[model samples]
Target: MESAETNTVSQDPKKQASYNTVETMEEVNDSPVEEVRLTVAITDDPTLPCLTFRTWVLGVISCAALAFLNQFFVYRQNALSVSSVSAQILVLPLGKLMAATLPTKAITIPGTKWSFTMNPGPFNLKEHCLITIFANAGVTGVYAVNIITIVKAFYHRRIDPVAAMLLTHSTQLLGYGWAGIFRKFLVDSPYMWWPANLVQVSLFRALHEVEVRPKGGLTRLQFFTAVSVSSFCYYIIPNYLFPSITALSFVCWIWKDSVTAQQIGGGIRGLGLGSIALDWSTIAAFVGSPLATPGFAILNMLVGFILIVYVVVPIAYWNNFYNAKRFPIVSSHVFDATGAPYNTSLILTGKSFEFNREGYDSYSKVNLSIFFVLIYGLSFAVLASTVSHVALFHGRTIWQQTKASFNDKFGDVHTRLMRKNYEAVPQWWFHGLLMVVLAVSMLACEGFGRQLQLPYWGVALAMALAFVFTLPVGVIAATTNQPAGLNVISEMIIGYMYPGKPLANVVFKTYGTISMSQAITFLSDFKLGHYMKIPPKSMFLVQLVGTVITSLVSFGTAWWLLTSIDYICDQSRLPPGSPWTCPGDDVFYSASIIWGVVGPLRMFGKLGLYPGMNYFFLFGLAAPLPVWYFARKYPDRKWISCINVPIILSGTMGMPVAKAVNSVSWFTVGIIFNWVVYRRFKAWWARHNYILSAGLDVGVAFMGTLCYFALQYYNIAGPSWWGLNIDDHCPLAKCPTAPGIQVGQCPVH
Candidate 1:
């Protein structure tokens, strides 16, 4: 007569085993009720110093280096943002090296009860974690920099440095408050595994845990080193000497002047159907590492990518949707209907800087490629569908956990261990931080009105939207490793409210999207700390200090780049084949025009050009209903429940900066690692999959950073042969060859 949950709990026998011996959560769930325990042990070891001198020194250096690297890569033609996992991998050797050699003497502070040691007892795991957290903050790339780049580089507008710094700092820190509040629901629950963190956890355990040398297999460290050296060496070819090898489309080579060949084989300009990328950066650029992503999620994303990039985009462009034939099929650059680059400066009133109707009419209406139009439509669908998907799948579990968190009655072993051993960060601290950031935000908003024309109320509304969306978005991110972005929704709202004011729209979107994203990122780190059994108070301090450091270092680096590099972002000023094209900034500038200057009322209204795109929001809202119903009705069909509509749509989000080769390469590697090896060689895959990914990422980043500074910055040319510099191997690939199109140069066969 007992319920299913009760009966299962009563029957399981291995549930009482010590958590350290438990290999997986599935084993814990199979065990008996009385023996139920977490898969990891909990301890309250006060002797370990997390904020030691060594920790600070190493953390600050890593943060500065990563911040510089992230900002540098953001401006590249083929943008490649490095992950914090690079820091996570690189710091292990440095931490150990520091532990081995740093003076062990304690430095007594002038204040009471605050003596610190340089060695900090073997550079303990807690200090290691804190340093990584510091690096993570900076490496996550400050989203607010996009606003500065668009205004300064593309719009040719000047912003006060002080105001810009304040804006960046406020938006980055505002998310921490929400992250603190959502800790109970997102961080405490064991089910919220934060899939990406598992890779870190696995690496940490491998690094710290003692193991007898096993025969016939490489140890984790051995495998990591082997892969790192090989990857680091191999990257030199694709990243520098033979950059064209990164995107080699055989079809284009065979038929030089064929439009079909260009569409299918051009890695940078087309769908990249037959292209093969040898570079790790190109492979992992858009979709992330194959080993880390789950097989099912990869499949879902692949389905979306194939349908949109291969089928929908070609059809729309061929049919001349919104005169798509007049422009390149895949470009981030904004253009007028006449196929000329959009000149917003010409259309703006000289005195007030408002959109001038006379100039606008003479300049002609703006145009978007069919692919760009699809991106906006799919983005709206993703925004609405994510909420509905989460509500249907995780609503009940979230409700139960919320009740338990409030009652302080922890059911999960992980939660029990956390509560028993760690001092929870005081709620007042988070609330106080939130209030301070909000006040600073108001001042920054006033500065925006003076400098950028964004009204103060729009700033407040942006914060409100961020607050409302944070929890739902956090839920999705924690569970799926894919965070639903607030970029599209925020831009739509602010664009309509502040029509004809491009700066104001971007400012509002920055606060709204960055706040929500930063919160989710902070929460993910919290979950990582939880998995490692790091103290909550230490985690809180590290995040707070890291965010501040990131703002200063990232903004400073960006400003320095903008000032020092002559015509860095302007393609005509820089030498040909230069990598600094600011592709992302171009996209950001285009969005500002499409959503802000023109406004959605005129672009997607009843009488607008692309009115059909407006219904995408409704389509998003309703798409998940039937799927959720089917999932509930047939719960046994596991694959049915794995269909994540949002993650699927996310495949197209990177279209502006990524080509089809990235996705194709990502899926191929993912299939090899997650599906093939995972199923056939379970033990080997489990032991080395994450280690391999971490190694590749670290190697590529380290080498890429070195090359950029050593050679690229000095303008030293690598042998300029066709083989080495493939930048112009397929020039006609970028040409628009639809009927009667005479825009770009197409080769005559």
Candidate 2:
């Protein structure tokens, strides 16, 4: 299973200095040979400085920068995220520069046994790893942004800054406890490779290992620099100057008046069959690096995407299922039966904000597009299928790992090295931390009852659900790169229990779903640390400190943005081509209505309009039976076993957040790089694929953030010409032609 891309080279100076020269001479002396390989254990040296002052200083700076950049992008129209790899790339050069410049003199602590050097011995790999981990913690999308958006944008209410900060901090830290407890199942297992971290590992080796210029072809560093510079230069074209290149649907341009053309070819409003996107940000929006993902997994996701978008959505819309034609084909905004935006504020009682039944009845009923409805259906399916698939395929192995966790036997070479060299963080430590956070969370829930509307018992229930679902979801994410979310299920349960309380529903969902997902994210990082030979204790401390710092910094930035940006979430107030469309927040607002304001009783009740959709939960439970039965009935058929229903269902979940062009372009790139290139040029692909991905991601993110601040912030327009901002290249793509669709005026044929 090991490839050059996934393997790490030793970073010990003695080994690196001689190995590179010797290997090169041998390659030249002998005929074509297999490339030099190494195990996951990158080095046997045990004196590497991990928790150094320099590490903390760089980490704090990176944490602050990443938190600001990520929070800034979360509010934008595209919601383009800057990955921690950006920090990794930027930190290496900075760390080296610091190592070269800083004094090597040691500082002694009075009345203490501790003495440390400021220079920290050439800024070792362990310190670099810790810094990246710290940056990763800060770069995670803050879930509290949704809470802030809903309160200000929809409820027209303001929360105190202290309360908001506490809420954000508690929710973010609550997951770390769960992550620690599940380390045995998720992190200790050898099979949980966490494919995404492999990219980071590859990049780390490239930066730290001894540099040798390649004879003919580009070296790793040169290729990385070239790709990064090119990607940085190219992103400006699609990001700012020519926005239409992001989604160029030729079909829509050719047949501007055809409704079917608009439906099939419009990247924003339709399946985006023939649409082409030039923007890397758009291509990598929902799905991650195509070069990193496996070809088989991408193919499965594509199948699901086609089935849901092309077949199910179009059929339901054309047939007028739930009056789909009355609304936009795709939108996260909830609408009334008359095609007007549903105003939840009008139906709320004075200050209490409780639902007013009479007011609700006077207003039109809530309606969702066919695509939105399908997202819900698939969400339920994902929940059931993930658990069932894991049990069917991995039950015995999970049990074995569980039993083996208590023993002294090592699972793999990496674990053996870790056990022999490093002191493991005791399980009791994690248990103690979990209990402390649990108590604080409970108190926070009680204190914020008036604002969140969630009682102490509701908080307990949410935590309980998180504990129950964490293992299954974590397993899926660790292996498959897709984590089946608990958002839909949590909302449904809390909506039924505490009906008619929108804030309470979201609060419960936040604790239940977000905590579990965050825990899984932390566990994946723990695994990454293990692969890189970082001590478990140092990893835990860095992650904890980083999370706390990130919460404070992110909250401050969000508060500043909310106060400074007039009409923050309102699109009408922003000028043309403004990035602050708040698409993610809009989706959150819509969910609060469907599951909170309306309540599950009204939305999924026997007399409800979408009552049939409720049966999706039952369908999900049964759907996995056939897949399992086929796998067992024909055990020799390996492909049958590989069909993961949960992963397939994840493909449909992107409808609310991402457009069709993203998926299509992502798949195309994956096919070319992962499938074609890897199969034809295995050595070159393995050596360069992930490095190229990392470089591109970092470059685009760096340039995109720079553009926002330099041009967008100062209101410096690109150009007034159609070529500069061609968002409306195919103007009729959004035209309203069907009956009851009056939002957009269409030209007569």
Candidate 3:
């Protein structure tokens, strides 16, 4: 363990203010990681203001707008996940503009001595950071909303909006409490540095760059603006005027008549051997922009994809293992012996929503497409592999950090400065928030008009589970920036403990998974704030308010979309290229069926069709061992250690929702930018790569929203020519290839 007294750095305010100077930097004895030292400015302008009137107006506006737009876009084909970077970039000018225009006079309250100014000095970096924090809350997808969407859209059940609101608020607030609780272990400790936040820090620093022209090349802001404009104009051709270009499956064009060819080449139904997506949303939709991940990480995912899609899936499918031949080779829908859609209403008792065993037996037992089943198996493997991988690779570092976290003397320069300058957020604040949210959560589950069916103890249990897994998962994310999710595990636990209650199962999963997830997200932001030197109290207040506003606005948008749209999320009824498939929610509803309605007993237990899939847990648990052993023995060979089993296993995990084209295009972009471009154009890439990514996301979000409100809502379908009307045009690609299987539009094999 680090000797606290030996590592202590002087927290002199005067010394910290000169941190940008070389001499001051040299005296930073308790320095952090290399990236932090290089990128994050150690300087602290304590005099600079935050949470100004300008911050409130701009922050609330960004929060509500982003929450509305993101929720609106989520129901579309390529779920547009516009991150806070978009807001981080957009709000710079707005904040400055507000500072210039707003009244500068200080206003005092009548009763209290509190006073504030609309224009709080200049638009400093701290103000910009807080606005982005608001955006962070808006950008965090409301995971619990999926419970509402799936129940209403997929399951055709009634979920009271009030209950939905309560559910969402509780799950979100649970994370706030966790974030506050684990601040020392996850935030203050330099070892638990959230790597992903480095990008934001760099961007913030770049935006705040005082030098107009560094070395005469285009500035980051200039490059970002240019790309943003280009990306905006380019999307219209694919998103509207020529939709077919989104999926340019040339192989489908080559052999349009052959099912084998389409199945091999189609981007959605098939392997996507030569398929390419021109649309940015299509490319970066399902699993996020591949440009965000490093080349090594992308390679790990690609390897996993190759194994699952090419090797394991083909073998199982061709051999008809688990009767895979009856269905499409790649599918997310549940099916029966005849490969027809397994109608949930047939087996589910009305009113009560209970499972009917006789109906289930009469109609056929629930069977999944081999791909989706394998996805679940791999998900289980990912959880185990993550634990094993972290333990083997990062255990000692974590242990040391755990011990060191208690002593403030061991804190780094940033931490020491923050502690001396700002008042820490009391632990009781989070504790109180947790207690209040828990109480309200229990009330919602038991008192809501709709029978949510989750008992009081279940809520407590879910919170406990989330509380337990926060640190391990937080450590994985803090270091690798890849969140090994607890969604599957939460579902499994709830399903086992409380079987045959769909509402209860999803509710439990939402609490167990999203609470942990939100905690990590908040902690990540806290790390970012810690790096930026935003006051801890202001950070807490901004996050809490932003989260509240975001949740409210998101729920409002969802309610509006679900109510207004004609045949929304029902692909069978909606027109071709309608852009409201709700693929993610489809996956959620599928889980609700498998683990909630059906329960684990009949699905993966002795009574289940494929109990052998359970061995995946053991396989995942053991998969990391050999890699760990070899890395220890070989020591010098670094590549062996880089083979991330969790990421590899997760490569093809999103088959149905994220089509082959998505992965292919994501991988290609990741390789080009993160590998080739990064290697060849190191300086230029470092300056503009992440900025370019943010610019692209902003452009797409702006144009996509414009298209929806201006054209799609009015039913102004773009030119119905071959290029605009048809997508990929692989007629038989989405169809099953087995003989005598009749599906709409597909010829018999």
Name every residue pair that clashes in candidate 1. 12-32, 15-31, 15-35, 16-35
TM of each candidate vs. truth: 0.92, 0.93, 0.93
In angstroms, the error of model 3 at 212 is: 4.3
> Candidate 2, TM-score vs. the true structure?
0.93
Best by lDDT: 3
Worst 10-residue lDDT window for candidate 3 reads: 1-10
Off by over 4 Å in 2: 1-43, 211-214, 726-741, 744-749
| Tens-digit lDDT string for candidate 3 (478-522) | 865667788888888888888888889999999899999999999
Better of 1 and 2 by TM-score: 2
lDDT of 2 by residue, 316-343 (tens): 9889888887776776777887666788
What is the lDDT of every predicted structure here? Answer: 0.76, 0.77, 0.80
